[model samples]
Target: MAGALDALWSQYTWALGNGDPRTDSWLLVHSPIPVTLLFVCYLLLVVAGPAVMRCREPLRLVGPLAAYNLGLVVLSGYIFYEMASVCWWCLFSKAIELLDTVFFVLRKKQEQITFLHVYHHSTMLFNWWAGVKFVPGGQAFFVGMLNALVHVFMYLYYGLACLGPRVRCHLWWKRHLTTLQLGQFVAIAVHSSYNLFAECPFPDGFNMAVLLYSLSLILLFLNFYYQTYLKGKQDKLT
Candidate 1:
């Protein structure tokens, strides 16, 4: 058992390398077990963390939450600019971004930690792992750039909201955040679909995965928008 595990680890680690000695260090993250374990823990937390807090009061992690969001804003920006140029840096940044849900779990904001949220965060780890392993450059980097731009604005909004009721007045467009997310998915789907016909060097499998994934997010987020915003507004009027 131990030998088999060691062999698996070695294979995944070696495969993560891009044949560049300068960045071979970053390939250490490709250890399949650790990455799988991390996501498994995250999934368990998504299921049990909220239930554990069910009887408890919601936590007010005002300062920590603000810092977390701001950190992501910076990290996303870094990934946006360096994704194609420095694949490891962007991959590392995205690995850190997965921690956002940990904040939600800690704050007992389980309601905010919806399935879509968990699914998105958790899957990105694996998806980006494949990306870093296979097609880590070229037009493949566009999605990360778009996602980073959106996250910069999104996290900036969350950071402001964490400041307290004083900032609520400026946050009138909270609903628009979801709209922006939907727009992002639409853009990703369109962006990915272009590869189907265009002569891009990126792999067909990865492009198909991106297109299908974006389409799924579009449908899911659209449902969330309707139920949370549109339907709620109608309920209030009637």
Candidate 2:
């Protein structure tokens, strides 16, 4: 069982050019054919798997779900600790972290994937890709740690959401989830900005891009919260 879970993670981890890949170009870094195939599979699963579940009696793998969520938290925490200790591998890990959204898709839950999702998913991979290619051991570590802690909470919500309405009432933190998500971006921007100006090895260009990108996400999420949760009288969360 452990081996199988490791294999699942390896499948995804190996797909993202090992994050700290030897090369920069996608073609030369690794087997694009295999990696692209796996990435496409992930994208398809997220985009289409939900509809399939709605059609097919709702597939449930609570055990894997639990492990995946908590396991990622542990992994992210370790990486964060490593970053804080010395080596900052968050940039590379974030590259492979493109798979984070797989959690939302598998549960047939659209509620978790919001505008924040689009922005984060779309750019996190690219930004981390840039960081890995350009900024080796960049300050992305701080951001990754913050993100992991948030995921501890986010995936806990996901794990409970998987319990199907029996535990749905406990998922009351959706509004705060958005707030927390927004907070993550703010923290990322602030920290990354500080690292940019402070004595650092990473390039200012990388810092600007990531910080700006995260800021854009913050604004988008704030607007989303106001419209979805705050503006509405009733809780329309899913």
Candidate 3:
């Protein structure tokens, strides 16, 4: 067993060594161990956090929530600006986004933690891990750039929502946010699909993975949109 484990570790290290040298020394990209552990901890928190909060009152986090969302808005904008130079920040943003789930659990907003929410948050880290590891730039940067831009507006909307009822009432573009997200996914799918037929320097496998992932998100978001907007409107009318 010990010898087998040693060989497995050696093979993992060899694979890591073959990844992009530019990102090899960057944080969380040196080895899969750190990111894997982080992912596991996130899952554990998702499972355990609600239980811990079950007995406690939902903490009112008005101030902190506002700050957090606005901060992310700034960070997302900055990532968009700097995406051309660095890709690791995009990967790191995925880890930061786990905080969204944490906030949901703290507020006892269990309904907000849907399968699409958790799956999108959790899987992005690993997918971008492979992205940042092997194909750090190229076609992948387009997806990151577009995502960061969308997040800037997304977080801004959430931050404004935390201001008060007055501010939220004025925020009439809520449904449009989902529309924007769907648009982003569509744009990414088209961009990634283009690479599939073209002679791109980036890996075809990565493009295909992204194309498929974007399609999955489109379906999931469409379901969410229908349930949240269309069905709710119809129910109200009846």
* Candidates arranged by lDDT, highest first: 3, 1, 2
Instruction: Let me know the TM-score candidate 2 reaches against the reference structure.
Output: 0.67
The digit string of per-residue lDDT tens for model 2 on 43-93 reads 676677677767655446677776666666666667656655423244444
Between prediction 1 and prediction 3, which has the larger TM-score?
A: 3
Q: Number of the top candidate by lDDT?
A: 3
> Could you tell me the lDDT of residue 203 within candidate 2?
69
What is candidate 1's local distance difference test score?
A: 0.78
Comparing 1 and 2 by lDDT, which wins? 1
Candidates 2 and 3, the one with greater TM-score: 3
As for candidate 1, its clashing pairs are none
Candidate whose TM-score is highest: 3
Taking the tens digit of each residue's C-alpha lDDT, what string does model 1 give over 140-207? 67887888888888999988998999996879988888888899989989988998889987777778
| Residue 23 error, candidate 2, Å | 9.1
Model 3 misplacement above 4 A: 1-11, 236-238
Candidate 2 wrong stretches, greater than 4 Å: 1-40, 46-54, 84-107, 110-115, 164-167, 195-201, 234-238
